[model samples]
Target: MTWRWLLLLISLTACQGPDQGDPYRPYLRVADKDDVPTLDPARGYDTASWQFEDLIFETLVDYNDEGQIIGELAQQWKAEANGTRFVFRLRDDAMFSHGRQVTAEDVRFAITRVLAPETGSPGRDFFLSVRGARTCDKPGCEVAGLVTLDNKTLVVEVEQPDPLFLHKMALPFASAVPPEIIVREGENFDFRPVGTGPFLLAERVAGQRLVLKPNPYYRGAVQPRLPGIVRFVGVPEDLAWMRYRAGLLDLAIIPPAEIPIVLRDPKLSRLLRTADTLRTQYVGLNCARPPFTDVRVRQAMNYAIDRRKLIAILHHRASPPQGIVPPTMPGYPQRPEPYPFDPPRALKLLQAAGLGGGFQATLWLRNDETAIRVAQSLQQDWERVGVRVRLKPVAWGPFLDAVRHNPNIDMFLLGWEADFPDPSNFLEVLFHSRQIGANNHTYYSNPVVDALLEQAASTTEPAQRTELYLLAEQRILDDAPWVLLYHPRTMLLSSDRLRGLRLHAWRPPRLAQLWFAEEKTEE
Candidate 1:
């Protein structure tokens, strides 16, 4: 057993160690976030997976690390007179890893796949808002929201006036696909991904490692400093740090709990730093089933949990949130009084809902050390309201699968980092009634809230967009769809030798921008 353990450690070290391919170029050291669930962009929704996709694949337009609109495949675009027709012109030189120039047809295919019911894409909700997008799901998207006008220009029509559609197009789901690969292989194409980004998928070994080499046809001014990125997964958090310290891993992700330890170390203090962001965390109440089915019960449960305790337990690494949209969000209005952490108030609501002594229920959460701790604290807090909470802690993979299999839990902890700096990403995706099934774990539905979110998404004017979101946020909070928790402050630790590891303007660390310092020889 000891030898086996030793071999496993050695393998991880080798997997994360700096590549010997290019001694002149320094590869950024990053912790392998987690096992990537899938590569089919439409299929899974994991942050770590998105981190890779953020580099490997891109949309017609892009949001830089600062969340600013930048061009990727689509060099430039224009909207037709009616404001319904959008024409995006692809770069003439853009080519996939297979050496094929990306075309309007590929964009048409990718968008349709996301909207197709057959694929069960998590992003379907966001795209379905486009005119005729739902039509693609049932039969074909031929006459749906999109059109392949030519090889270079693709157009889309929305049901309503949506000026912000272009902004949303800058996000990932709307990204153009390599039609040849996805069509020829189907599921097999997932393992062998081909994209037109700064990086190309080099190698992937299941439950082990993934490597990305720079795209030869990359169309960027500042070329990626690293020749290739090799990602190793399932490295335990503590072991990940140890591996980094041993110079086996280049980038180490320091969890909120370990931030202090990394900062205190003299060798590590220079490497350790904070990457702040408005990363919201919450427990989604299973509003589709009984107990939580009653809005008052949901509200009661919300009041039962102490938001302050949650942030404190997490080492003040998060800000309390009254709803999905935090105050930092552009259009969010400050709610003076949050859901008070009063057990008596909770009892009253439960009693009013005809459950005076509270009820027995199960709350689900990812089986990580930190997630389990949060769930345990929630259980303890709700118990004070006479709510007997059963804790269901499963590993991240199984937990997400179980929740999607059946949205029947009384509650489950969920984390959402902004996909784009937009309110619709927060409201419509989670609370929209049509967005249920595998992706919509909350099972939230309210006609009024839905309308507001739709209105917000379509409105192009910044002020008007904010107003709609303000209403939407208030509505969701008053109804207590989920026990809104806290917005997390991302804490990152790096080696003193690493530079530019700071959180990008778009909110998360830009893996592509990280650089290593030059080594010194002994005197």
Candidate 2:
């Protein structure tokens, strides 16, 4: 390790230890970089919000460790009408934290709430396949497709046979919320949410911290063994590492700069955990704007960067991306490199696109240290190919707002994590023209790609669906709306006192499964 990093680690080790007053406290303390924006499932979209939502809310279905969809609130479900209609049987013992019995009506209300235009849920597009969802815009409009036959039984019908409907049902957007609570709390419901999950939100101190306690009414297969979970929010990665070494945090995300140092330390290396995630980090080129409007320019941008060097900058914590679809997802084509590191080819393409003299464009990105470093690398790489790049660093929330709302944004660095273990989550949700203003920030449009995505969505046969997705993905790659960067692997350091903490490929960590070593004997 470098002398500078070694001295930094030594200084961190010299700090005082964690508070001794809580030595016997059973709550697992964690350090998070940002505060959760919302706890309501319908409004929560970011990773920080999803982590808390996953703990406090219960979806109808969930993914098993094997990546298969399994029942959660719904004990059993059957597809009928050629996979167009689904009937779900809820568990009779499921009860919300507010002492209300979870019922079919609650499930129906939760889904319809997302479809309601008043809700303004970004996830509304995910549920557009449900019948009557498109037309149900007004508040309090009953969706004709969602039927509550009994307290424990519900039925959902779609406009067409959707092979991944069950997968969509497993998302946090489809989490069940009590209708009574919504009626009573109204807009305040986002903060005072009550659900049938393993944990209940005990306290939230805005930008400081959040405390969660076990839900007594939770009847899930695996019970929460930890007494509670405490998250120290708004803690920067550098401070988080120092706090982790001082024993204040049970878990901390290893920042890019500190990763090598941690790996070199024998004791810290033993606490380090790494796992490949279904996420893709890329630079989005605005296809609707100047320069990038030409397909050749977009392809040139992709060819300019050396992915291997980018991975090296990340300390080899990421793999070179083959395409938009991550390798972990099914139907990912193992094709030849689409755009290798060839600055000459990139300059030639730019010249053909009438930009031989080079053009200036601003690249917007998150202000985080890691993002800034990557952006700097990209700026250096593009400069070699006669592309003058200006970097604009903004905070995470404002950065997303500028990308989504500002038409002047030329290019931006972002990452997309798979919401479901399907290629459509990457291909269709990103490249489909219908998703332009939503997840498709590039505003790319291709009729052939859209048709293939539609066909794949309705195709019930897995093999045929995979083929259609592959075709759409290839078309998207040819379009080159994004300069594909790398697929990052999640790296975290956990305290030795914590056990049963595993990183999932796509979903949030299963907090219910985590327990302290001291508590394991009691269990």
Candidate 3:
């Protein structure tokens, strides 16, 4: 019995040592933001949760740094029956961290679990195109679209032709799960996530920290060269910056207030890296309510704010956006000069809409210093046009709830990042009438815009789709459902020794290929 225990311990520690491929770097250290509301992949729609989930889960498809879709778990796939049906071939070599082979059955079960209404996954809308996906109201609710032909082959059939369906599968929500573990653990499974990715969740200290170790059975294009990773959660932004500067942390975001200080110092500035993100921040106006329901009033609000100045103050790392779609995405149209900072025009529009005296409304914001600054700037700008603004700052969870369902919410500060790089993600999900209370928080609806978006989704021709999408965008711009702000740039500070780091707009930095050189003393 003692000899058997010795063998079991040896088997467990076999893959725990430093990788032979890269002998120097043994661990990767990062800051885990406190903003991560949940570690549950299905319920976590924020950037923080997605970043950690990407390390622990393997999606069927994934995107490269250039936004090209590539295979992750599924070795290859074929689009059959005019893009409505897709057949995926899973690699027999792929295995979970628990020493179980990943199969087509696992893929089928994972997707259906997300679509199950009982899970209340915020990402359920992404899978509605799958046949019978809407019927997943309970546990074990069958998804007719998901079919496992064998251990390696799986098929999915959608109701209509969707060219972007493959891209959607690359999202972290499409990660494969082991059915046996899920059935055994039930609702508590996400706390101890099991997947076939480059890393496995070794420890999670509730909301404080999460630790990961490399999985030897991972069969992806990239593998974790580091032996372990530690993500420090609930650390204050300023503390994170201090730790990075003191060499206690390897990577962290440069706090907005500290950017100038870092830029002034040559040594610190050398560590800074920045890239424009695919997210667009905006102030949503309730189109269902009065005062904002009038197109003239909405347009007046759009013209009143000085976006360029606000970008300079609140987000020096951001670029002024002419439209909702960020510049990072393809097919973004060239735009005319933005509405132009003309207060007289805004005043005239307000008078034309019988709101010459303006109206009083509350502006909702999350409990963030940056958001509060932006809100104050807008309040002062709108005052010139006779609109009195009352500011209300709430915690993260309550803020989302109020913004999504509260009828009294006149306006709110929020942002959206594309789950996949396509115009339909913004046009159809954010502004389309069908998503009124769901993704369309503004309650915006236009028959013409809806028709154009629907046509664009179904159209296979690239040129035709672009034309239809652009037309819908123009219509939305004309209606002014939101005061489109700027697209922020994601900035990071890392030790100069960190190599092979690739930042992505939709996902977190790909850390599997990341390695570190020997530390050097600063000049």
Per-candidate TM equals 0.89, 0.93, 0.88
lDDT of 1 by residue, 327-438 (tens): 5664556665468788888998999999997789888887666787788889899889889989887666677778777655667888887766667777777777767774
Ranking by TM-score: 2, 1, 3
Model 3 lDDT at residue 511: 74
lDDT (C-alpha) at residue 87 in model 1: 79
For each predicted model, how many residue pairs clash, with residues at least 3 apart or on different chains?
10, 0, 0
What is the Cα-based lDDT of residue 82 in candidate 1? Answer: 69
Give candidate 1's error at residue 522 in angstroms: 4.8
Candidates in descending lDDT order: 2, 3, 1
Best by lDDT: 2
| Between candidates 2 and 3, the TM-score winner | 2
**Candidate 2: tens digits of C-alpha lDDT, residues 1-523:** 5576567666656644344445424688887656676889998777777888999998999988768888999999999998889999999999999888999988888898888878878788898888888888754468878888999999999999887799899999999998878889888887788999999999888778889999999999889989999988777667777777767788888878888899999999988888888899999999999999999999999999998998888999998887888887765657666789999999999999999999999999987768988999999999999999999997666777788778789999999999988888888888889887777889899999999998888787888888898888889899999999998999888888888878889977777788888534423
Estimate candidate 3's RMSD in Å: 8.8
lDDT for 325 (candidate 2): 82
Cα shift from native, residue 434, model 2 (Å): 1.2
TM-score of 2: 0.93
